[model samples]
Target: MKTVVITGGAGFLGSHLCDLFIKKGHRVICLDNFLTGKKSNVAALERDRHFVLVEQDVSRPFRVAGSVHLILHFASPASPVDYYRYPLETMRVGSMGTHHALELARAKKAVFLMASTSEIYGDPLVHPQTEEYWGNVNPIGPRSVYDETKRFSEALTMAYRRAYLLDTKIVRIFNTYGPRMRIDDGRAIPNFIAQALKNKPLTIYGNGMQTRSFCYVSDLVEGIYRLSRSRYHDPVNLGNPREMTLKELIVFIRTMTNSKSKIVYKPLPKDDPKQRQPDISRARVLLKWQPRVAVEEGLPTTIAWFRDRI
Candidate 1:
């Protein structure tokens, strides 16, 4: 069996990936510092003999004990709220953390996969963001900490691939929601679901016209796995292509939870993308992957998960 090392393996996305790799009978070494990640997300895997948890900050220089067949660098504060609060830390993880992860991959001759985000396409000028779009991000904005760091990480990953001939891949993840998301992570999905469940006002920023495409965690994880095994060295967008407005999502959540919460309007955060959607043509042709979960199906599942937590 292969031995895989996943940085940030205790966070929402990382934990799910750890489970995926372990289920396939591979030995998994999970690394995290708990800066934004929680140990509970990965608590279930602690009992497994093949699963190993290493409390580490990827931004710092560190080492894994043995040979690693794959290195998935997913260590970073993901949400806007988290990144804004920990700007310097976020930048360090993306830049230095990615450097260390690449170094490890190089030493082990392992396939390195970097988890990027669609936020790189900030305030996207294009309707449906394709892999070719260079993106329209403000370098000094509040959101730049997360956006530019990911951009830097992608460039760094590509540099290693070109200079050292490392086996490397990058996947640009879009909005993903699932069971383990923190209640206060401050993403719209969790915010909306929590408010609906508690019968609190569902807040909407900027008239709620801003759009986003949601992909279930399972589908995103599947796409990541496929891209890791593929020969493609460039970045691939992995997210559901179906788009919906924020207001529409709130309405759906309210109805699903059977809540009486009223809609409340608030100013949109600066640099929030007016429109966001992924053009997955490359993923389909290269990885033979497309998201199978529809919002209609995915939303209810998420609501149910949050219901229990709330």
Candidate 2:
């Protein structure tokens, strides 16, 4: 069986990755600092012989047993409220944390898959951002700390691949939602859902005209697993092609929960994308991956999950 190490293995995406690796008959070493990770996410895996959790900060160098077959780096504050509130910590983890993961990958001679975000697209001018787009980003803006750090993380990975001949891959993830999402966050899906469930006014920023593509977490994880097993070394976009506006999304959530909440408008946050979607042609062509779960199918499950929690 292959041995795999996943950073941030207790967070929403990381916890899911740990489960996937362990289920596929791989020894999973989950490294997380619990900065934003929840213990409940990994509680189910504690009984599994193949699953091990280690609370380690990736800012420092650490060692793991056995030769790791793959390293999934998903350790960073992903939400806007997170990055904005803890900008330095976010930057450190993205920069220093990624450096440590790359070192671990090199030590184990493993394939390292860096979880880059579509945030690198930064208010994308392109309709559906492809892997080739350079992106229109503000270097000194509020989102720059996160955006530039990811850009650096990608650059560092590419350099390591070229210089050290290490096997590395990158997936620029777009909007993903499902169980275990942070209810306090400002992501439209969770934000709207949480507000609606609590019988609070649903807040819409900037006329709610901004659009985003939503990918179910299951589909995203499937794509990540496929990319990790493949030989492609460059970045690939993994996201749902289905797009919708904020207003339409709020209405959908209101209908989904059968809540009596009215829509309230607020000024758009700085650096909010006008339009964002992924061009997954590369993922489709290379990894043979396309999102299977529709937003309709994914949303109900999420709504139920949140309903149970709050």
Candidate 3:
């Protein structure tokens, strides 16, 4: 079995990757500092003999005991609230933490997969963002900490592939929601769900006309797994192509929860993309993958999980 090291393995997406790898009969070494990740996310795996949890700040250099077959660098604060709260830390993880992960991959001769986000296509001038899009990010804007760092990480990953001949893969993830997402994730799905469950006002920014494409977490991880095993060295967009507006999302959640929550309007955050969607044509051709779960099929399960937690 391959020994896979996952940085930020206790966070929302990372924890799910941990579960996927272990289920596929691989040894998993999970490293996290619990800054934005919670230990409870992976608590269920603590007793497994093949699962190893290491409390580590990956922005600092670290070493693993054995040979690693793959390293997935997913150690960064993803949400606006978390990044705005810890901007410098977010930058460090994207830069220094990514450097350390790449160094470890070089040492072990392991395939490296960098988890990137669609935010790289900030305020995207392109309607359905493709990997070819250079993006329209405001470098000095409030969201630069997350966007630019990810852009830097992508550049660094490509550099390693060119210079060191490292087998590196990058996946540009779009909006994903599922179980284990923090209720206060500061993203649209969880925020609306949490508010609906509590009978609170569902807040919508920017007249709720801006659009986003949501991919269920299970479908996203499956595509990621496929990419990890493939020979593709460039960034592949992994998200559902189905697009919806924020107002529609709010109404759906409210109806699903059978809540009396009213809609509240708020000013859109600066530099927030007016439209967000991915052109997954590359993923379809290269990975033979496309998202299977629809919002209609996935949201109920997510809402049910939140109901139990609340």
Candidate 4:
């Protein structure tokens, strides 16, 4: 069995990757600093023979005794609240941390897979952002701190692939949601869920017309897995292509949670994308992957996880 090391493995997506690797009969090593991640996410897997959890930051060079066949570099502050709260940390993880992971991958002679985001295509002028489209990103904006870092990360990944002949896979993930997402994380879906659960008004920005395509975490994880195992070296977009307005999403969440919360409009945040939908034609053709979990089916599953009012 191959040994897989997943940095930031105690997080929402990282923990899920850990579970997937362990379930596949591989020796899994999970590393995290616990800045935004929780221990409970990986607590259940602590006792498993195939699972090993390491509480450490990836910005610093890390090592393991045995050879790791694969490394999933997922360390970063992904959410708005997180980036706003820890901008410097986000920059460090995306820049230095990604470099450190690359170094480790070289040491272990493993395939390096990065969990990049669709935010690289900031406030996209392109209708459906594709892997080939050069993004329209602002360097001075607040979102630049995260967006630019990811862009640099991708650049470096490509450089490593050519310079070092490293096997690298980069997947540009879209807005993914599911259970284990912290209620206070301050993303749209979780924010709506938390507000509805508290019987409070759901917040919508700029008249709630802005649109984003949400991919279920399970579907995203599956796509990432497929890309990592495939020969696709360029970044692949893995997300649901179904677009929905913020207002429509809030309404759907209300129905799913059976909440009586009214909608409240707020000033839009800095550099919030007006439209975002991934063009997954590449993923479909190369990886044979398409998101199957529609928003309708995903909402109830997520609601059930948070139904007890945490």
User: What is the per-residue lDDT of model 3 for residues 247-283, given as tens digits with 9 covering 90 to 100?
Assistant: 9888889989999999999998898899999999999
Model 2 C-alpha lDDT per residue in residues 4-87, reported as the tens digit of each score: 899999999999999888888899999999887788999999999999999999977888877888999999988998889889
Q: Candidate 4 vs. truth: CA RMSD?
A: 0.8
Greater-TM-score candidate between 1 and 4: 1
Residue-pair clashes per prediction, in order, are 0, 0, 0, 0
Query: After best superposition, candidate 4 residue 133: deviation in angstroms?
Result: 1.0
**Candidates' lDDT values, in order?**
0.94, 0.92, 0.95, 0.91
Between candidates 3 and 4, the TM-score winner: 3
**Displacement of the residue 31 alpha carbon in candidate 1, Å:** 0.1
Reference-based lDDT, residue 190, model 4: 90
Write the residue-wise lDDT of candidate 1 on 133-178 in tens digits: 9999999999999999999999999999999999999999999998
Clash-forming residue pairs, model 1: none
How does model 3 fare in lDDT?
Answer: 0.95
In model 4, the runs with Cα more than 4 Å from the true position are: none
| Structural similarity to truth (TM-score) of each candidate | 0.99, 0.99, 0.99, 0.98
The predictions' CA RMSDs to the true structure, in order, are: 0.7, 0.8, 0.6, 0.8
Query: Which residue window of length 10 is worst by lDDT in model 1?
Result: 293-302
